[model samples]
Target: MDINQTTESYLLNAIQNKRLSHTYMFEGDTLETLRRYGMFFALNIFGDTPRNQSLLVEGNHPDFYYLHTDENSIKKEAVGELMHVMNNKPTESEYKVYIIEAFDKLTPQAENSLLKFLEEPPEKTIAILLTIDKSNILPTIHSRAQHVHIKGQSSDRLKELEYLSEADLQTLDVLSLNAQHIKDTGENFTKLRSAAAEFSSKWINGHSLVLLDIKPMLDLCAERRDYSLLLQLIDGYVRQALHSKLKLDIFEPFKEGVKVDNIIGVNHLTNMLDEIEQANKMIQFNVHPMLAFEGMVIISKG
Candidate 1:
């Protein structure tokens, strides 16, 4: 189940026939993928051309607005600001488009505010909400927007997997066995994956002092504002370590530098994963990146 030709055709036809929905929900495995599709949809609405498409991709279009959770949940105030913006006429195009990333992270109050706007969207204004988990979105909002599920083929995924280092691929293999997927292949993500592997090896070897080793990585994550990917990488390593201890052959490559016996027990790993999730939630709510990373480090130490 991937974003095949059929999905692409349907969306294009909808735009050409002037049947595009006023509000849409794009659900997918990765934010980057969702964003790609969202930009496609937006460019089509504005009459797709090389220049306009490039502007949309670079986020330079005046009529296009992109929003995401800021340090925390999408607050009510942000929604209010969006509503105000939407109420105005399009600045340079026939339609104004708003794309919100991590829509499920919107606070309850923000959802209420959004619901009102969705109930009666301004004419020629389009709203695109992107989320990895559709179930977390409010039912009322769900009813108002058309849902689009974006899936990627394993074969295509493997192609992107080529960009990863041997070690990163091994970590990804472990995650795949557990039904987890990482679709990013950017250089920054590759570097983060390597850092995660090194950090996991040291942490499992009972070298709490290795905190110094990860400080630079933490700073990089903060600089890039990529807390989500950082957490995902850490989560992958923990899961891989757990599989290694269980003598899972699929995780063998990842076991090279890991001390199998020194790895935390399954129970502790489970708890640590839970704590990491909580830390991610805190970040969604807008906690400082350094604070969130420090908190996760402290949890791992314990």
Candidate 2:
């Protein structure tokens, strides 16, 4: 299983040209991916010598150190440990390397500490800050690091328009029926999210989705490989609509049926888009997945 070659080529060019930056920010959706990119680059740069692995396991690599919170590991004193290491001369390799994962989780105090370090980092020392949540990152930190983004694919949605112009009576009727159903249901956020997930899942699994259900998922979709997050969100909207519909009388315009509070109109839908965009930004910045995920639920409910 290999990743797309863009990242590999970028790193290869940097290494080959000997133009490695003092810090690199690697962002993506998959943990395994983030880990591999860091480890692979670390090994390629400093892993060849026997001392490399030995120092890594011993937690005293002169050339490389990883700061993270893990099993029996220190809580993320990332900036401090990194600064400490930078103060020392490299005992083993040609360059000092710091690989920091989840940079978005750095507390405010830590971010401040990091900002200072970034302001005047030691020479020949390289740092990589990895995150999926870019939303909450301090502007200073963002400005300090050169960013690299890795986009994944959506394996959920299927071939939606099976023959748009075709006039097969049964098929045409089915599509028309589906289209009308979506318009009839309305704008319920929670219901929409769930319906979208269910519909997409069914479609991808070789089952038919009610066209009404499929429409709203497409109404506001993600561009990259963020289809997973987008679909789950569609589910949230549906449920929200269901809960709110009891008090409101306006539920037309979803084009996909979702229950919504009477107050939830086009403006609410527009607001929801803003919120989701923020959530996606959070993911890109390396905010905790749970933080971003739960935030979506809350936003939909609101």
Return the top candidate by lDDT: 1
lDDT of 2 by residue, 48-108 (tens): 5676766766877667877776532223365686789787877777788888876766777
RMSD of 2: 14.7
Model 1 per-residue lDDT tens digits across residues 117-160 = 99999999999998876756789889988999876343433555
TM-score of each: 0.54, 0.52
Native-to-model Cα distance after best TM-score fit, residue 181 in candidate 1, in Å: 8.6
Clashes of 1: 7
How high is the lDDT of residue 228 in model 1?
68
